[model samples]
Target: MAAPIDRPGARWGVAMCHGFSGSPSSVAPWAKGLAARGFDVEVPRLPGHGTDWRDLEGRRWREWTECFEEACARVAARNDVVFLAGLSMGGAIALRTASRLPVAGVAVVNPGLGFYDWRVRYIGAIRHFLRTTAPIDEPAAPEPVGDEGDYPVTPLAAVYELRQLFRATDRALPKVTAPLLAFKSDADPVVPPSSMTRILRRVASDDVEFVPLHESPHVATRDREALLIVARTAEFFERCAAKAAHPAVGA
Candidate 1:
């Protein structure tokens, strides 16, 4: 794991997670943006990420979830309030963490809770013959979007493992109580629209808010609405932290 971006002097902490096969660079901007506001931030690079795609071949979903939990624990220890944010697959990891942890809030951008394509369901059956596929990165945005340092190819076994993670996360959704802010892109090419709907339907969180992004793709953090993501996340964190500190006087 790369050194996490830590900023001192804040009682609140925010832990950000990147997408599957992607490095911390994917969430670096949002992490830094939170840090700039004086909140301690940690963005841990998951196992097999920031390296060759082959390195990610056999890793399981448990490993990724474990890493995310550990990262959240580290931040929770030092801060009175903690918020978790993630992109794509990382959103599933964040949701899993929120289900188990005492987090103040969670923000998921284009969370990959389910796939619209039926072909992804067959990864386990064909992994023995087809080990990997072409790079999953989408075409460049009209503007220069920085590279997220993701793997060049998608690992078949890893994809299967992600499916497992999604199932596990879905099972745990009703246990989650933390306030949730889900950002869905109207034109996302990677994650299906059902991904966000699944979360809304299952999670027990009463304080849920959904924001629709009209322009961004699956990687909203790097899209044209990137700054909006940062601002909304920061605001959501602040509101949740406040609510945690001062619950409504009555009832």
Candidate 2:
């Protein structure tokens, strides 16, 4: 994990999260962009990640949340306002964090709310016999800018834990009141469109923006519209954080 990156401006903070298997590098570009715009950016490594798949074998989703929450607490204590942003599984974690923490806003890209494959549901049935993890066959991305920080494989045990996290996120959705932003790739192969719809329908956040990406794949943060994502996310955080700090002159 990288040390906390900060730039002196506005007393604001943004906690950026990478995907389930990825390292800080997954969200690094966005973090740097936000940091350059004067928001302190903290990109923490997810538990059992950035090392190897075996390390993640028996890890639970609670550990992931605990790791991210501790980082969020640190950011919240330093800045007057704080926001959460994440990609893939991190997106789900950010939403879960928003439900618990008093952050100003939340943003996500291609969040993995559920798997696109039918076989994923059966992982639990075969866990005892399979013991280890196996890769699923999928078509390649046309314009792949892979998450270099990611593990090549995912443990079946981790998949079960991730499923639990998604279920918990669904239950906690109505509790999230912060402003929200989401970027969904029209043709994401990893996560389905249902993920975004789930948030729009479930979250209590009245301030929400759902941006559709036509030219990007699952890793939109590092894809063709990568710069666009950075620009839009930074703008959302700025506007929402300002709105949070200074409300309208009252009714």
Candidate 3:
């Protein structure tokens, strides 16, 4: 886990999570963009990531959630308000974590709720025969998204574990009441469109905005529109923070 920027008098903090099989480097650029704008940030390297795929193969999805929870705890301890953000699988984890914690807001890109592949349902049995599956293709995003440090071959066991995480997140979606901002690349080859749709449908947040990343792929965090994500997310964070400071009149 990278130490968060500890600026004095920083009242708000953001904790970002990387996708499965990926380290914090994948989201470092986005985090740096936020930190540059005076937001204290923590991008945690999830357990069993940033090393060999075999290491990840042995880990379950719960371990990933624990790491994310721990990172959020670190930021929430110092800041009066905290926001959550993530990309890909990290986005899914962020949503689940938000349901568990009291966050001011959440911003995510390409959050995975369900996969395009139907075989994922059978991964539990299939893993006995196949040890690994082909990894995500190199995104042809016109410009480079940098090296995401993704696993060359995804372990079948990990895929199964991800499925379990998605199930748990799907069930917990209704508990996410914080203001939310979500992005989904129209051409995303990884997570299906249902991911964004399901989150919007299930979350209890009255303040929800879903942006479509036109022509972008799954790795929008580093794609050509990466800066767009950073800018819009920062704006959302500020708005949410202001709302937290003064709530609307109620009955």
Candidate 4:
């Protein structure tokens, strides 16, 4: 299992969360990129992730979200400005966190809020009979990059938990007021485009920006447009940090 990544020394901190069934490796590059810029960065390995899929079978969304919340609290304690970045299910966790916490900003890529396929709705009913499902697809990355460590199988129980999380996150979206930076791949196979549309429409954030990735798939962090993602993420966090430090006095 890959260990968490932490870099210290800076007034601003970023807590990055990986997607479901994905380890910290998925977002390691993005964390390092921000750390290199001198901001404290932390990439936490979610509960039951970076390990056997069976370990994820009984875990609920609350466990995953709590782990992320702990990491955010640690980062926020040390830095004047703090932000959250996540992919897929992690994005849902981040949005949920932002609704309750006073984070400076939020950045999400290929956020999996809801699925278009009707099959997922029935997972809860059939999960007791089917323990696990086959791997969805082989990890794809650019030439020099290797696959980000992900589980070989999907746990049906965990999928049900994710569905529950999506419903809760959707309900909480109207309460998230932090500046948001959302990136979506036009060809993502795992998460449908509705995920992005729903977030944009429901989130109460006044400052929101969406970037479309034409060539990447679900895991855009490790795909061809990774550098662009790093750049935009850094730029967005910097902008948020600046605003937090020097807020306007009156309307």
Candidate 5:
């Protein structure tokens, strides 16, 4: 992944976190944009990602969280102000980190807490059917933006662990002090709108802002509104920058 931020004189550093079963390559455009805006960017490749699908068979949530925590530590060390941006599962990791770190701000895109309902339990059956008799349109699109195909079949054990992460982070939500910019899609096939609402309502900081992507699907980072995502994200971060530069004067 690129070093979190790259503007020669930029003071704040940004860490770009990718979703579960996704690699930094998928978040490249956002990282590049952040870099263009003078933020050092680091898109860390989570454990079990960017490798053969089977390599994820033995991996656990701890492996992925640790990788991001390490990246945050590295970025935090080099810059005076550090920010975070993540997609899907990466968003959860960003929240988890924000709860513990002195992060300046965070931007979350379609952060996945978990599947919506019990039917999620049937994912294995669905995967089997798709692999055997049916072929779903490759979850990652082709040509326009191809799926590198490094992710593994969803592991029940890992899913269970991710649930634990959600609960833990939910409890920590009210404690995070950083500013937040959360984005969710109206047509998302994966995440529910309620989850995004919950995050916005629970965070202790009143600096949280939510933007609904009306036309995109779950992966709004790669969806049609991607430019809007990038533009709005930069605008939000810039607002935070201005806040830091000019704190309110005493009455």
Candidate 6:
């Protein structure tokens, strides 16, 4: 584990998790920008990601969370202050970690709270049909970025695990202590607006803030407003750290 510093000194560390079936490259640019602004960013490649899709097929949610936890430990050991950030399923992992760990705060990009559409509601049925009937090797364009048109066909088991993670994180929201900065793209076709509203309304901490990306899609981390998201997040965490260092007088 990286040593946690009492103060950030010249740098504050951040552990960034990529979405399911996605690689660190997806969020590397965002991390780079944060690092340029004096943040020690650690973007871990999720288990079975960045490799063949089947390599990740047999893996479960624990593998993904454990990988992130290990990375967070390393960053926490080295930096006095650390923030957890993620995209999609990775956002849920960030929330889960902050809910239990002693971290500065969290920045969730398009957090997967719950599916509102019927097609998504019955995703498992489609997954089964695809899994047993026809496996799609052609990757769909990565939303928000649209750089990659190919993605590993999601494994049914892994999707199920993600569903469990979503449920578990929803249950744990009221226990989260870290301040949160959550972003959602109004045009996002993947994550529903209800999920973002629920986080804003139900999360235990009052230090939560929401940013609605006007025209962005699901992957706001890589959208046109990506840089703004990163800047705003860094600013928010910096304020949290400042408040922690020097509290306001009178309760």
Q: Model 2: which ten-residue window has the lowest total lDDT?
A: 1-10
**Candidate 3 lDDT, 51-121, residue by residue in tens:** 99999998999999999999999999988989999999999999999999999999999999999999999
Give the alpha-carbon lDDT of every model.
0.86, 0.83, 0.89, 0.87, 0.74, 0.76
Worst lDDT 10-window in candidate 5: 130-139
Candidate 1 vs 3: which has more lDDT: 3
Clash pairs, candidate 6, are: 2-74, 2-77, 2-78, 3-77, 3-78, 4-77, 5-79, 5-80, 139-150, 139-151
What are the runs in model 5 whose C-alpha is more than 4 Å off? Answer: 1-10, 119-143, 146-152, 249-251
Per-residue lDDT of candidate 1, residues 39-147 (tens digit):
7899988888888888899688898989989999899898888999999999999999998889999999999988766888887897888988875556565664577
- Residue 51 of model 4 has an lDDT of 84
lDDT of 6: 0.76
Clashes of each: 0, 0, 0, 0, 7, 10
Q: Please give the TM-score that candidate 5 achieves against the real structure.
A: 0.84
Candidate 4, which segments miss by more than 4 Å at Cα? 1-10
Candidate 5, residues 111-184, lDDT tens digits: the string is: 87766766546644554444322111234432335453335365544455566677777888888778999988
Each model's TM-score? 0.93, 0.90, 0.94, 0.93, 0.84, 0.85
Q: What is the lDDT of candidate 5?
A: 0.74
Greater-TM-score candidate between 4 and 6: 4
Order by lDDT, highest first: 3, 4, 1, 2, 6, 5
TM-score: model 4 vs. ground truth: 0.93
**Clashing residue pairs, candidate 4?**
none
lDDT of 6 by residue, 56-112 (tens): 767878888899999999998888778999987789889988887888789989888
Q: Model 3's lDDT to the true fold?
A: 0.89
In angstroms, give how far residue 227 of model 5 lies from its true place.
1.2
Ranked by lDDT, the better of candidates 2 and 6 is 2
Say which candidate scores most in lDDT.
Answer: 3
Could you say which candidate leads in TM-score?
3
